[model samples]
Target: MVVRRRAAPPERCRPSPYGLRPGWDWTARAADAFGRAWHLADRYPYRGTEFDSSFVGIFRVDAADLFSAAPDLVNPAWAEATGQQLQDMVPSYDFHRLEQLPQVLVEAARESGALPAVRDGQMRTARVCGLRAWLHGYRRDQAGSLIPVDAVRWDGGVHHALSVTDDSTDAELAAAARRAEQDAAARGIKLIGASRWVEQLRAARRTAVREQLAGLRDEIAALEDRLKPARKRRTVLVTRILGWDGERDTDTALGRDAGLSHTAVRTLRTALEADQEDRGGEEGGPLAGLFR
Candidate 1:
């Protein structure tokens, strides 16, 4: 009753309208245009990701489209030339393929003093326009590529939110300390001892805070450790339940679940079996074979 897993599918090529088409002499034209525009863009005093002629074939036509739409808005003579070169190279360019070009030209225009704004306004616009377009383009590409982007954006937003939340919490704690100090002073206790008294209060508060933080950190670590064993056990149990093909190796299952090397998993499984045998369980039971 062995279960055979399906084979992994072959990778698919990404669709590219500007890519090589049958019986088209577009490669040479694309190469030449890309090289010229890339060189011109390199000379411009723009700062950020260094895109060269290699990306010219990809973004050139779209940049040219932007120029056509708002010729006065983005007045970079090189950008216009680059766009024309791209058009000449790929006459039947896909509009979807040109998505990134508009953003690139916007950046170039900003760098060239074609787009003027205050620092704050510029940053906001860059985030909205540049970042948004980049994200959209990235998402449309594939799932795996999008995962890292999602992780980074999630981690960044969470980190920033935590910083603000922590600051507010600290402010509240400080205000509470101030009130406690005022109440102590109203009792006519020598204000000379105020500094020492405040110090003691803060030290006590900090000890409790440190203890609480330590407990939380320990809890998180423990949960992570527990998840390792649980995931390993789950993999083994699932394989057994599903009656999967190939030899069942608990060591391999544990290794995969815990992100450990196969050798480490084998070593761990050996150790586990030794411990189990010491307690006198049947040598060939479901659990016994698992450790073996």
Candidate 2:
């Protein structure tokens, strides 16, 4: 008898005022508002991760009412890489006119081949970037006839097909050659091809760093080896000084040997003596009467 484990089920999309809803997609909504955000952000810049997190807050109230529950719907991985930024320092999303979340989610889910046609999948990773790029290619007027992403519908399916460009059908190749010629004239760089120039620059930097660091590392290793015996000697001296019970000159002599300042040696000696006294140095404790 063979038993197989079942795949984990997808997240449910219940009706709520929050991050994700049926017809609303916060990621796209956030990206759409980004242009406006940048226009206003000319006055003040997004400090750090604030712009990313701000979109979530706006999405919660404006897009889906996500603040009520499961508020962190704008996954961090997507939000940070996403080019969207909030227009206001504080979010005041005005998406009520465009609000049709459940329907939008249903359509997105259908496009993505989700069973029962639920909500949109996480759209930030490169996995869905192709879909996003394709969607944005169409004008708003052309949205009605725009192709969706269903495998069954085979919409925008040519992208999935691998088309080799023979010399006869090499339009992109010809365009690239023209661009290269123009660029070579305008900028006296990349004459040997852009990719080759980039690789050469990278290789040169790596070689320089590796060659310099190899000698530096060897020098460091040699110095560390030389210091090993000295470290042992220092430890032994510190131990002996601690056992000196209450000797003052022993400390001075130890400092001279250790190449430490006399004041530092005196301080160490005082501490050891204090420690010995605390541990009954007057009664010939193991740590007492070393130099005395």
Candidate 3:
């Protein structure tokens, strides 16, 4: 048997551009660095760092925000991490919104020890209470260099946003941006509450009922087609008719047996005669015009 050894990945001095962080870079930067695998995180499969976990746990983000940010990136387990990372910045320092963060708060975050900074800036999204926000952590441009997190929806003033991972290959980061932009625009309606969900469910059920009824109508039509041959072979023994007299008309005997009135018997005979004339079948007979 022949074996081809696999080369190791490059030492990651920095993590993938994201809100989550690691407790330490590595114990010994060795393949046997077991300590790198241990940590206390918010969601299971506990990823990121203690800081990341606390931030996410403290500020519960709405599912809609995460979905609109980059739905493709969200998994059940990843929601906790992504939610914290993508959520809009809460009120902090003096800025109502991060886009408009006062120089003082920005400096405080950068200089102060309470807040964590990524390379050159705060790790969290800018604060703007009651406004939507989107953050794409450090991303790579087409030229292949890091572009730090900046609120995309912070168009000048009224805070509104969504967030996504920016640290990735140039193509992937660009793609994420495009997805975030389109998703935010398309899913603007706040479809979060129970009422909205119920409305959607009701609409779906109504559509299902309409589809089922159409299927039933098709089934009934098919059944009728199958019954055509049987109907042709069958005959009614003495089906009732109105106005018949056995003594007066030849059809009277059938009418009486069938519980029809005298007039009905006469009417049946007249109809046969007319049909015979129209078809030019038999000249005259009791059974005339009965398919000749």
Candidate 4:
């Protein structure tokens, strides 16, 4: 037997103090706002997997509340990313006036299929940008009037898109491009298509470090191999010195012949004596007489 899971309840709309516009369905509006929230998330600056936990209530503002004069955000994602709330920066918004804009109406008409959305097979979505308000997901009513289903709205200070053209002087055009790049960067949007290039650079650096470490390890091993005979010779000399019943001059002469400093030779003899003592000089070992 299969148990079917119940669908989640639709998001409830927060009542606007200014009152919602008539003839708009709450469910449809909420869904549209939900879609816009995802759009905002995709376009949000400083959002990575870091903001995944805050995705739950990102669209806290209802459709009616969005166009209202208030600017406060109930979602913590913006605050977590920017270190401040939206209302802290933008005290108020004039999104209500967006629907009445002439450009918005024209764009709405085009999207609703009331007018041609493209010219010469070029889509208006690409061409009709950098506007104060962008109307999208529009539909035509029985009366042939265009109704915008959703909108991406911003105030005068904020631009929803950036467009640069060569129509200006070379310096002016370059400046515009630079400004556009800066704006996109500020929003954490990649305009130059460098994500793959950046990953490749990181991979190359990692591979280079790995190879350098391997080369260093090989060099260390070779140096260690070269020192093996010298180390073995030193061990034999230490053993001979442990059994030597000679004067200080003779000890010094032996150390000098073995290329060991007098101090180093003395330290080795002391260390060997300590080791033998730890093992109780093992019944007439070389260091037994000295310990006794």
Which candidate wins on lDDT? 1
Off by over 4 Å in 3: 1-191, 234-270, 277-292
Q: Give per-model TM-scores.
A: 0.22, 0.23, 0.27, 0.27
Global lDDT of each candidate = 0.41, 0.39, 0.36, 0.40
Ranking by lDDT: 1, 4, 2, 3
lDDT for residue 18 in candidate 3, whole number 0-100: 22
User: By TM-score, how accurate is candidate 2?
Assistant: 0.23
lDDT of 2 at 283: 64
Off by over 4 Å in 2: 1-183, 186-190, 247-292
Candidate 1 differs from the real structure by a C-alpha RMSD in angstroms, to one decimal, of 26.4
State each candidate's clash count: 0, 16, 17, 0
Q: Report the lDDT of model 1 for residue 258.
A: 58
Root-mean-square deviation of Cα positions for candidate 2 versus the true structure, in angstroms: 21.8
RMSD of 3: 20.3
